[model samples]
Target: MKLLHYTYRKLSLLLLLLMAAWGVLFYYAIIDEVMDETDDTLENYSEILINNALMDPSVLETEGTLMSFYKFRPISEEEAEDYDEKYYDSTVYIESEDEDEPVRVLKTVFRMPDGQYYELELMISILERDDMVEAILWYLGALFLLFLICTSIGTRLILQSVFRPLQRLLDWLQQIQPGKELPVLDNPTKIREFQQLGEAAVDMGNRSYKAYEEQKQFIENASHELQTPLAIVRGKVELLAENESMTEQQLKELDEIYATLGRAVRLNKSLLLLSRIENGQYTETEDVSVDEVLDELLPDLMDIYEGKKIHLVRIKGEEPFVIRCNLSLTQILVSNLVKNSLVHNHAGGELYIETTSSSLIIKNSGEHPLDGEKLFRRFYRSIDGKKDSTGLGLAIARSIAISASLSLTYKWQEGMHLFLLVKESEKKS
Candidate 1:
């Protein structure tokens, strides 16, 4: 859930609980007031009855069947002396209605003329009060529901407006690519915290960009500076190998030194290529097809590896697997993957290359699973890796893939090492 929705849920739940509690309290409060009023009416009516009974005793006998029902019963003197007034809720049967009706009842003892004791009871209907309470309860529930709905919507809109700056900042951060200059951030807000956050982000981005440029420049200068000395040393080794006066042992040592120099030169070149790729030096790009690059490189590679008798399997989809990237980098990336497969394969091993509209897959026969985690690290060589292998091929390929918004991943399955390359867009889809 989004932060806005998450916060709104908690607020709405709190509001719901509070409104329910208050509504219940308000409802009972109204009922209590109504009950007090009813009791007051009964007390006033009882007082009038008692006064009339003292003045004229016949009123008691004749007034028993009134609309507000009442009754009188003769009692002993001792009972009257100890009698107390009582009020409660009850039901009574009316012969005319043929059913029982709810009533508010009051009972009291009184002294009549000639010192005679009599008991008096009074009742009043309260059906209307019960109906009114039910209606109020229903209305209160509906009001609470309506208010809750309105409050929820209002809170959502307000939260959206309030968090607009943060959302924009997140989007701007996403647009930032490594080695690329930061875009201008235009998120203006009055909130102090968000303003500070934006400033911090921009400051950090500027510092990071400055550091990246310095590192990229240093690598380029170092690689180019070392290249001339390395070439001169290799040349001196070649000349040393040409001495006719040298012993066989000396010649063998010269050849070993030359081979070591060649390996060093290759390592330096790979590192330069990898640094260039990561630094975004190859900005020029075009639509390039992986299968096309393979077709171009495969003929010479196959001839070179013909001694291995490696079986080749190529599965091409009807549509070519194409992506937008520097044409040179794309070629290098494809060459590295294909060459690594060939160079590492055993005699009479297999090479499988499959290209779909969105991805490229290369699998080569292997005895054991290579370390997928360390395979892409620079200078990561397997135990059985060839002595002449520079071990930077996959690393350079991975750098190119990242710069081009592509994913390069490795896995081992069924005695084969598999490399998969895919566009980030196609993966999301």
Candidate 2:
């Protein structure tokens, strides 16, 4: 979840728990105060009745008025010795009202003038008290609910406002690319920590871009510097091969040296191309059809590796796969992949090339699976790879694909090494 929602959820849960606890405590406190008031009223009423009954002996047995709700019972000395005053809630039925009335009851033991002990049971109606308590509970619940909702909404808004700066910084960071200039970050916040974070991010991006340029410049210059010398050495070795006085072993060694020198030259060129691609030096671009590039490269590659007798198979969709990329880079990318397959194939192996409107799949027959993880790393060659192979073909192909906004991936299927290339957008989609 996003940071805002995550924080909001936790805060709301804590608030709910705190409010529930507060509501419980407050509810009991109100109930306690109400009960105390009821008990006090009962105590006063009972005192008045006891005084009247002592003044007039018939008052206890009076049946004409509210006295019907009270009773006086004779008790023995033993019962009077253990008697205690009591107050509680109960209900009484009245035939005139046709309903039960809630009341507060008080019981006490009193001695009459005749030397007889009596127990007085007196009660007062509390129907209004019960209604007040019920009303308090309803309003209390409604108020708590309203308070929680208002606070939750207010808290969410505050959290969103508080985290706006961090969100802006994150958005700015996402738009910063390696070769492209970082976009302007216009986030203006009063917070000190967010300001520092934005400054740090911009500083890091500048330093990274500087380092990337320097690295690419070094690689390009080194590759260019090595080429002429490598060509000169090979030229001198070829001129030496013209001497007739040399023995068979001597010529054989010279050929081996020449072949090794050729691989070095190819490696230097591959590095130069890679450096150029990453530096965005090839600014010229066009809509290039992938199937067209494959068609042009396959003929020459097949002729060059004719001795292998590799069977070629092509599967094409009705619509052609096209991409927007530098023309030279596109050709190089296609050439490297097709050339690699031809050079690596064994005698009588198969080469399968399939194309769709958005993708290309090239599968070359192999004895076993290659290491998919390290297969694209520069100078990563299989154990039984051809001696003349430079090991930079697939690496160059992958680099070009990335530079052209495409994706190149590899897999092994059914004794074939499969290389797939597709536009980055289509691949992601």
Candidate 3:
């Protein structure tokens, strides 16, 4: 996802969290106020009933059938004994005497006009309070759902306005390509940060494209310049060899000069290959099997190591490992890695090659230890000033690996140097 899209999502989530918190607080506040009012009203009504009952207990006791408050028939006289243990689901009961029962009693004493004794008993309905709480809860839940929906819509609309310019900027940036100028930034961004980023992006694109042009020109010019000198050197060596009057020492010296010139020519060729890979001239790609490439290069490897005591051990894999890549570069990358292993190995050391589902691994025991990080750097070596080694083996391997959209990694395990070639598809996971 793009940065603007991610930022908008986060902002919407933050707003949603805030709205939820505010809604919970509002619900609790309203519920508390409603409960307080209900409590006061119930208390006042209980007091009035108690005052009436004390003036006349006849309100609770009936002649034919005893009636309680609100004219509800009380239990029969025979059922009264068990009625004390029984409970009505909708009503609360209170008694006048003993005062040890769990039921609530609203008590008050009032003197009769004729000085007669009377006991007043009253019960309140607890269901009304329960019903009021339930209703408030139901309303709170419904309002919370409504608030959630409204916040969601509001968040989407607000973010759309805020991020519209960002989306445009992203589309513009993706359209940019190397060696091309950046498109003009025409978006009227309300956000200051986005405007600054747009300006920076345009500046960076121009600078990088210019640098790329300069680098490519330098490589092309240097390759051509080196080729002219190489041609002159080869011509001089041929003329010297054609001469017959030269002394024995002069001939040996001339031969050494020719060999040195040959090494220089090979080094220049390698540099030219490196530059070509860097310039991305080989854009053709195909689904190439790593094993097939390895197999095709096996004869060349055998020719190079013909006299050496190194044993080449090839462990074939059961499954086919295929990747979309440039064929020549892939062969160069794997060949360079395997050749580097052989060149650096100890005398009579074993060179091992194997493949996994995602990669090819080459391992060999060596006389020299390598700093893995410095191995890929141009013209860097762990040995003390060894001129026989070009030091470009790993560098070339790395360059080709990158061009093929693969990774070339080196590690040391159990006194053996391990080089891993991971295909691009494997790296995605």
Q: In terms of lDDT, which candidate is strongest?
A: 1
Best by TM-score: 1
Once fitted onto the true fold, the runs of candidate 1 whose alpha carbons sit more than 4 angstroms away are 62-67, 74-87, 92-101, 108-120, 127-134, 175-177, 243-257
Task: Kindly list the per-residue Cα lDDT of model 3 for residues 145-218, writing each as its tens digit.
Answer: 68767866786678788878878878888987655666777888869998898788878888988987888788
- Scored by lDDT, model 3 comes in at 0.71
Write one digit per residue (lDDT tens) for candidate 2, span 50-73: 898899888878532442367788
lDDT of 1 at 313: 96
Candidate order by decreasing lDDT: 1, 2, 3
Query: Candidate 2 — which residues are off by over 4 angstroms?
Result: 57-59, 62-70, 86-106, 113-115, 122-145, 180-184, 243-245, 275-285, 403-405, 424-429
lDDT of 3 at 174: 90
C-alpha RMSD (angstroms) for model 1: 3.4
Best-to-worst order by TM-score is 1, 2, 3
| lDDT tens readout by residue for model 1, 201-234 | 9999999889998999899899999899999999
lDDT of 1 at 427: 83
Give the per-residue Cα lDDT of candidate 3 at 362. Answer: 93
